[model samples]
Target: MMKGLVSFFFLLAGCHQAAGAVNTKTILLFPEATSTNYVSLKPTEKVLHQITVCLRSYTDLTREHSLFSLATPNKDNAFLIYFSPPNNISISINNEDIFIKVDPDVYYWKKTCVTWDSTNGLLQLWINNKRYPRRVTKTRSPIGPQMSVVLGQEQDSYGGGFDINQSFLGEMCDVNMWDSVLPETSVRVILTDQFSLTGNIYNWNDENFQVHGPILVLKDQYI
Candidate 1:
């Protein structure tokens, strides 16, 4: 009986080694291109008229991969940030995918941000603080509640059906999201690391997310 209990405790600890939240200076390292590794962000339940997501990642993947994925019950690609090597990045809102052609150098410690507003239906993507041409979509629909936000894999279902080919394989950090569209000045400050403006909706911290599988949360300076 004693041996069994000890083994069970060890198993629990190993399964939950990095299961809690992550900090601002922390980076999540998805060591392989498997669909099982991911981070699930938990934010308060609320309808969103606007949203802004920003994060930095270091990777050398040449194929298409998912950087951020948010899904509703009905729409798996409700808010997805997917990238195809060289110059293509796509932002899908309410199942609509829009592409933005950017400079070819999009890997290795890249900073990315995307914003959308329902009031004006304006969408923008920023790479290293460089804003691209704005577009519009889903002009009047505010995103409903019940969101399943996942990092490292694209969801083909509400919270399941992950594809290995679309899984993010790299080190990701500074993942944050806001309920409002951030201004240019605020974005510039974030890109420059002038201030640590955490997102009201979701931000990288020690209490906002859950890690799964064999992922590592390491301090940023080491990498």
Candidate 2:
């Protein structure tokens, strides 16, 4: 009996640490919108001169919502993925907002990928295998370490200061982040299959991430 109790405690300890790749047929479901309900994603990598973030999300919210929030030190919006209403998707890199007007068909569940290169400040957004026109931002700063990545709530500060108004109310899964920007062909292949590529920085299969508030990890059938 004591042996089983010890194993149980070890399993509980695993729940709050680094996450492995359990996100395969699994989805991180944020069933409600609240300031406290969110998941904190830890990127194993530190410095990033370029970045590629890809994730699949399903939501019916018409108002503006935050899909991905990455905060570091004084730069609260160091790198963020935000959506407004029907088709306005904005990616904020180092507090500079670059908007991308996507097709209306992307309003539902879809796969989205965004890549940014600090060399020339080039940014590209791809949705459902189709790449939109790329844009150039003026911020070529390198994102340092100490990144606080959150899923549900947008962080006004480094790790705290969450507002319920911009909270995400839906399901998100297959979130992968690479320290280097992936090629266009690679992004196209990833849009077809979620398992085609895995993120070196933030692998979705890593099962050791922390869950705050009330979030559900359910199979695709439940979604």
Candidate 3:
């Protein structure tokens, strides 16, 4: 009986390890990506929006153009990408490359980062929450129809066209989408560590397990 109790405790410990603590405060909650619960942001807001999606690499279609679809952080526009990996791990939006690289020293093993400039509508690259000093572009474009967001598969294309050997293969957590450009301090606070922001947050996990729905909603005033 004593041995059985010890074994049970060990099992519990393992379970806890497997189910790591997800930073719920930063987790964005959408209506399962199947409902009309998203908004759109276009030329008015231009290139500002929020986003949170999980990525995985385990399909046979070997291209990088049909794996994910995005809402315009508002309900006015949408974009889809069919991505296949191992060549250039980046997603292109408005002809700009928003890439992901793994840093050996950061918390996330591989972080998909792209910096958005609120002042002039530009982007920069940062792998694993580390910001690059230079801004990449300064073009502003209209985004999409804010509707159902898709993960693991693109909405229009069945299989992304590419090499068929590359795909996103991992779990995405703490997915968040913000409409305005977050300050450097704010990004560091949420990305580097775990904390809550006052008003600009769009989606957040109500619990660690993602069982609760997104409870916060605001107008497009964060920008």
TM-score for each predicted model, relative to the true structure: 0.86, 0.85, 0.46
Point out where model 3 deviates above 4 Å: 1-68, 71-87, 95-108, 117-119, 145-148, 154-167, 194-202, 206-223
Q: What value does the lDDT take at residue 76 in candidate 1?
A: 92
lDDT of 3 by residue, 38-119 (tens): 2221112334443222221223222443334454433311444433333334544544545544233222334333445434
- lDDT tens string, model 2, 46-135? 779999999989988888889899998979999999988787888999999998888774446678899999999999999888899999
Model 1 segments beyond 4 Å from truth? 1-24, 220-223
Q: Which pairs of residues clash in candidate 1, taking residues 3 or more apart in a chain or in different chains?
A: 22-205
lDDT per model vs. reference: 0.86, 0.84, 0.38
Relative to the true structure, candidate 2 has a C-alpha RMSD (angstroms) of 9.4
Order the candidates by TM-score, highest first: 1, 2, 3
Q: Tens digit of lDDT per residue, candidate 1, span 37-144?
A: 888998757999999999998999999999999999988998999999988999999888999899896546898999999898899899987999999986467776
Clashes of each: 1, 11, 34
Worst 10 residues of 2 by lDDT: 15-24
Error of 1 at 132 (Å): 0.6
Our tally of clashes for model 1 stands at 1
TM-score of candidate 2 to 2 decimals: 0.85
Task: Return the top candidate by TM-score.
Answer: 1
Error of 3 at 105 (Å): 11
